[model samples]
Target: MEEFSPRILPLLWRRSVPARRAVGRPPRLSVDIVVTTAIRLADTEGLEAASMARVAAELSVATMSLYTYVPSRPELVDLMVDEVLWARGLTSDGTFRERVLLYAERTFAMYRAHPWLAEVPRARPPVGPGMLAEQEYVLAAVATLGLPVRELNRAAAGITTWVTSAARHEAESALLRRTTGLSSDEWWQQRGELWENWFDVGSHPTMTMIWNAGAFDRGADQQAQDAYEYGLGLLLAGIERSVEGDDRVP
Candidate 1:
């Protein structure tokens, strides 16, 4: 398994100037526009490319105009995240494993929809109604696992962390392919040229086997949900196996 990225809690901050609400004035704007504009910026230019100025430029509004709709970039991010995460969800009307798998698939779908989401830190928990609903639904799905709250929390965190780590890998790999002008499969086909001379026969048999099978075959599927589900099953299976001898899971 690949290692997890250092727990990066990228700071989300509010815009410095607060919206000035004049006495006896109605609300200046709706939250929907602010949320949608922020999401569009992220989807198009990437998360780091999104800022108040960029969002305003996208919306064709003055930068100060957004303050009335959102307090700050962090608040806008919170809202944008909530909007996308709930676009689809899982149900609890199935076996625990089935339900968890469905949830895992749904989680990956959102990340695939907006790749930047996988990079957002969960420093401050999502508090929007949609995000709360997603959390509640996931919690309910794992209820049958019979693990303590902390253990269940850890399991959920592990699954999500794994998803993001994998997504980051695929995203970076895609960028490298574009930059170096070589598909992963092409890179793998020629990788031996770089190290075939140094590879020892006995110690590198495993690598040789993968190379023979085209180890660089990144799935050509538009969505990587199946890959995510496959990994989720292995993780859940390992946990189940570990708990079998213990009296923890009934």
Candidate 2:
């Protein structure tokens, strides 16, 4: 097997070689134009619709011309993610809980605005100014807990993972509803016969008890919001306990 070489980091760090200047006229397309156009396409049509050919078509340029600005689709996506992060610029002010909640809310809002973002894998996130800024904000917020550097790092990572995962779930659910033309409630209602005919109280006594107690009566949107809030409260409480030298935190 061949060793994999990465190209995106150079472009992201602005160390990639400049496009060869054409002898005749100045180039019409720019890196910003290509990236912004790709972002717009992804916003409306999805990540798949932001292909080089499609973006080039939107910009009225030859598909090959896009290479002058972006190396490839993956690089373009990296650029797009960084641009969105840079534009949003998460803040680090307010009380610790307030700051964390605000950051999570803003991140979720970004996913809502650009659902395609939820599709981008961030296991090895792009190391650009935007990503660094987000890291800085997260560290500053987590630092309020006054944990050691190791604990602070772990807390930041854990919080980011939880918040992003929740946001992704929300975005995916919205996309499913849009694509299938059916709200979650409507979908469940369509399957109502299972509850009416096949539901066994003995087999699922807890579920039956909860159903009778109206525990599952809320709208999907409200349920999702409530779940997020509940989880956030628990997370903050845990952090507070850890700060007080709780042995369970480890």
Candidate 3:
């Protein structure tokens, strides 16, 4: 068995790939090019579609040539994830909550841009430089909240979890719409009627009451953008309470 080295595929930053031969003409291929092509393939199709052969085909190069720069598929995927995570723009200005919200929004937008990111498995801890930079940015934003190290780590994790899940849902909704040829409203409208026809409203009074109130229509599914904002607001409120040292439930 052999250990993995992080230096094998350094695609976290925008840099040219090492030339195949040390004393020859500039390398025609670069790691950045490979990773970018890989990301584009994943974005257009899905993660599974971004195979090394497919990426090499897109790059007009031989599959084995790619291995010269990128060690393997898993390494390439790691580079891709780090590259996108590095794209998140974090700011330390503004109040703590404001900074956190801005960071979360930017992170969410990044996930939406590269939805296939959710498909990547975290088999090991993130040891890439880009991931470390992101963690530092997040920790700095929440450092002033007067939280213990454990609580601070938990808060950051919670924020990332919420943003990732929300953005993944958004991406999935878009994919579903493309596959089904139906908008959210259209899909839900058909399902709403089925529920109306099949369910005994008399027995489920609470559900019936809410349904009659048009809550679901005006709720989470109607406008995902609004739903995201609403959820973010609630999450921010909870974070605010935690910051104020009132994290305990009533």
Highest TM-score: give the candidate number: 2
1 or 3: which has the higher TM-score?
Answer: 3
Q: lDDT per residue, candidate 1, 1-250, as tens digits?
A: 6332222122122222375666896654567676777787777767866788887787788889877667677667777787776666545689767776676667656666677775677655455556566667766665566766766766666665665566655655555564588866666667666565777767888877876787535544332545665787787776556455574533
Global lDDT scores for all candidate models: 0.64, 0.83, 0.74
Clashes of each: 0, 0, 0
Candidate 3: pairs in clash: none
TM-score of 1: 0.68
Q: Rank the candidates by lDDT, best first.
A: 2, 3, 1
C-alpha TM-scores of all predictions: 0.68, 0.89, 0.82
Q: Which residue runs of candidate 2 sit more than 4 Å off their true CA positions? A: 1-5, 15-26, 245-248
Model 2 is weakest, by summed lDDT over 10 consecutive residues, at 1-10
Ranking by TM-score: 2, 3, 1
In angstroms, the error of model 2 at 147 is 0.7
Write down the RMSD of candidate 3 (Cα, Å).
Answer: 3.7
